[model samples]
Target: MTTPTLPENGEHLLARATAILAKGSQIEIRNLVRSLYPAEAAFVLEALEPEPRASLWRLIPPGVMGEVLIELNVEVATALLAITDRKDLMAATEQMGADGMVDLLHVLPEPLLSQVMESIGVHNRNRFEQALSYREHTAGGLMSQDVLTIRADVTLDVVSRYLRLRGRVPAGTDSLIVVDRKDSFQGVLAISQLLTHDPHTKVSELMDTKSPGISYKTPSRDVAALFERRKLLSVPVLADDGKVLGRITIDDILDVIREEADHSLMSMAGLTEEHDMFAPVVASAKRRALWLGVNLLTAFLAAWVIDLFEDTIQQIVVLAVLMPIVASMGGIAGSQTLTLVVRGLALGQISGGNARGLLFKEISVGLLNGLIWAVVVAAVAGVWFHNPHIGILLGAAMLINLVCAAFSGVAIPVLLQKIGVDPALAGGVLLTTVTDVVGFMTFLGLATLFLL
Candidate 1:
């Protein structure tokens, strides 16, 4: 087949694919998609809704199905797999890397999982099971059993000849793993060194021994951080006894980083990163309703706080006019601090060592900002309503609420994390609640004491 001109990016590819699909020309659509890479095709599939996605999925050849399926999101992949026949699913998964297969298995039904396991043969089945043994978001689960290991005693010439005999190395193969006779990992022999160094040099002599191995149980987040900090191409996952289980490549690390970003963004809204953007209306609503209900409850709590000063609101109509400003400013301020703390926690930047320092820093920031904005808002309110007393009361309230907001923003995430709750999912609601209640109470309470 002649080479096809590739689209510039995913969006352009998607647009062209949509145009082809819109024409109802299956052959043209298939031809156009066949030329795209698995990852690109996966992106297209993700962008398309279910019905069109199914039609496109059928056009992809079986040879690339495993790769394409692996690239799609777990929910989307499972949906497609549900429609596929047992034989086809087996065929598609048979060629997948250990980590990819493990990922696919996590979403598969038990019966189908069994059948898939039966087809993978004994050696691969053990590897798959070993990988599955780890939590899905751990280093072992993210690693592939497919590795090229060489004995440390071997010379570069011997290692080079062995690789030649094997015909091809694995993708992302930057180094040959060096291990002892017992299969315990020793070090890594760089591919560059293998190609450039004296062929007679011993693997042990040339290998990089200082590079650390990731424990099989290390969290996937930590794994991604390691790859980033070390600028690693791949790292070995090791058993407690130092035996090598498999390897995690830079590709896997990239996936972890992307998922983390998605997770952080989604969790702020009390949603998971895996949520399908175009899921059925009822299903989507049902999932969202839970968070909505939580937010509603918090809203009621804030309303109750406002209700406590209901007469105050009535006594001063101006207070009713200006209540939202205090609450809104506090909410925005608290959200900023909360987001920073959450991000710091996620990156392992904040800990016991610096927690007190950070808390002091955030509160100090809040005090400074609160003073500045309180003066601004107070000036605006005093001038607008021609009431200096009201302006002074509002200013004090703003300063008080902002300081409270800063404290809550710093404290909430740390407390939630300590209690094993995800701060990202819960922090915003709590911070908003605190800010609103405190902002309203402080402003109105001051009004009650002075204006009443």
Candidate 2:
């Protein structure tokens, strides 16, 4: 078992690194991995075959495993789950940070989840279960339960003493969570500052008494947003009883943002995030088909409006050809506004305090944009259709649909947010339906009045 020279590409390097482990040569692999950067090491670890990968479980130490697990995808985590026994799984998950464990656990089945949860110590089990109990998108679910804390009144000597003790500051820990004697959260202390502090000082002597923390029940999505707002490395999580339960770290928030951003992008296009290699091609198609069905249903509403103007469309072939332009423009504009509103909600903006202002802002934007596009497209259509009258009709139709699209786009998400609904879920459907309806009606109705 000797170190192999690095390769050119990530995949080639990853293969060579994984090959060393396959030959049961951990000593050489560990040394080589330690020398390489974390990114390269992560790729190597992720590329390993399941059997060899799990073998690293006993070979590599917790510190290394923690870093590697953070880089692995759900598929690789699933592979790890299949090969490792429950006890080994628990140990490995514990070695990883709390939030990392949650992310991995989310990729497993119910039976495995419960089994792993049960294998940890009672205290660890409690903390893990409590985090698992949180709603998936809230702050509580994504936060870790392993932060260090101290009473505000504690002297600098106590803080210094505790830190010097082995395992008091866990390796790979996010930050120290400061607390009152009653276990109420007080502030956050970074590891750098704690190590640098004088032996005579107390934690209470530190400044910034007002630290940002969340209730244990806050949504994980909200938790991620809080981390972004405060620019914190970690934020302490507390219970209603004021006991400090855990902490949320930037690492967890980064994953949350990535996953949520993916989910939002997919859902807005009416798709879910359940596809995988194990999933059958038919299964993936079916899941996608369900959303396509929703779109089909909504399309009928647009079709019915077109049917209403069947007489006019038949009389003028130009009306039939130009029909798609109005709806397409409105749909695109509406999607722009809808995407902004929905993303704003995910980021914890667009609150009741500013809903009225946001609404006004969207309407103003719509009016300005509608006027600008109406002029541009109208001139183009006038030249294309070779009729000033047709241009007038198209311009008015564009203005009507754009205003409607923008208005409905903002309104739909706000209404959903108001009703304790997720602004991200189903927002696209409602916005599209409204835009389609307006687009069809405005175009054909105006044609019937003026063009006919």
Candidate 3:
């Protein structure tokens, strides 16, 4: 199927939003979101100034805010919600689907919990509130309340008739769920199953109960794994009571991935996935600075190795300039390995048992790449610096750095997991720091021995 076309605001929309927000002109910003398509409206809402974003957020309808909130980063959503009224907050909450509400409630603190709960429709409030009791990372917290449930004893004609009402559910519905009169989950019947089945058959006769579905207490990431593994479009969410609470659609699972992915990507680059544009530059800088400071500490350790080679550097000025290249190459090479491992681990493709095999593959890749690249750099250093000994130094250091880089890059994530750290949270910084320090130390340490 062809993908729907997203708005092409592209380059200049941000420029325009900046201009509008800078004027403190609420009307212009409000008009921007109003004028755009729902997706575009969301984008515009996101780009509006923080001051105006909060002030003007209330001006937009709650439905619009809910739609836009899903598109906005959690940090930004938190900020916007902070200034919004309980009614508006609840309106947004009620407008959101089960999985979306799960995400919102997960982040929304306890004090505001009661207010937000009060706003959700009474029927759904119990289901959503039930999900809230599950552990944070579990399936229940990520499941949607937008399931279609039918009594198992209902006749095929009756089931088909009920399934025909797919689009009518309050939270927005698609899939059909089957349950006994006691509300215990029986099986799941897709919407298509209803139309295809004979009208006289019972729901219990028509539904597919044996299909695999995760319980609500499994971690959200594991829930994602089930979708990929089973190739399902939607999975049912069950209460502790075994009643069908909702179904977590693929879109909801995809959102979990997207959010986690955003966290990984932004955190990797030393940026926090925050929503507040109004936060002082210093605050943003401070967040970056902590990681930068960590990187700086590692860089200094690299420099300390150079300090040990001051004599060699003074004798051959070219070694000083050329060393960074060797280290930088290793850093880049290490990052490539790091990305692959991190993604594999996150996706469940590489688990604890297979991680060793992955390590072997990454290390081999690093070694082969180092050998090829080392030859190029060593040859260049030999000609550029007019010294055969320096060439040998470069070759040896490149090989060492690459090997070390590979080991460190793969190992850090694995180690973090072993210790119960969210490896994605700080893996990039730690991995980069490892490669950087090792590269510098090896490059300069080799130079000191061979060149001097």
* Number of the predicted model whose lDDT against the real structure is largest: 1
List RMSD in Å for every model shown. Answer: 2.1, 5.4, 4.0
Clashes of each: 0, 10, 5
Q: Report, for every candidate in turn, its global Cα lDDT versus the true structure.
A: 0.88, 0.73, 0.73
Q: Residues 1-452, candidate 3, lDDT per residue (tens digit)?
A: 99997655645776776676678766786786576554555566566666666665667777666666666666776777777777777667766666667666766767897777776678778877777777766776666655667887877777655645654653434456777879888777666766787778777776788866567877888888888888888777776788776677777778678767777877676675653555668777777778778878877787776787788779878877877887787888778877887787788787768888888988898889889887887788788778877887788888888988888878988888779876777787777677767777787777676556
lDDT of 2: 0.73
lDDT of 1 by residue, 1-452 (tens): 99996457867888988999999987788787778899998888899988999998888877678788777877788788888867777787867766667777887878998988898789888877877788889998788888999998889999989989999998898988889989998999889998798999998898999978989999999998888888999999999999998899998889999999999999998889776777889989999899899889999998998899988888788898999999999999999999999999898888998999999999999999999998998899999999999998998999998889999999999999999999999999999989988988899999999999
Determine the C-alpha RMSD for candidate 1 after optimal superposition of all C-alphas: 2.1
Colliding residue pairs in candidate 2: 137-220, 137-221, 138-219, 138-220, 139-218, 139-219, 139-220, 155-202, 156-201, 156-202
Model 3: pairs clashing at backbone N, Cα or C within 3 Å = 75-275, 76-275, 148-177, 156-201, 157-199
Candidate 2, 1-452: lDDT as tens digits: 99897445986676666667667666877676666554466555555554555565445554555456556565565555566555555566667665667666666678887777777689877766666777766666666666677776776667667777844565457567777768877776665666678856766666356777788778777777777777877777788887887777677778788778777876666655433434446866887787788889999988998899999898877888777888888888888888888878777777888877887887788788888988888898889989878878888888888888888888899898878876677888878888878888898898899867
lDDT of candidate 3? 0.73
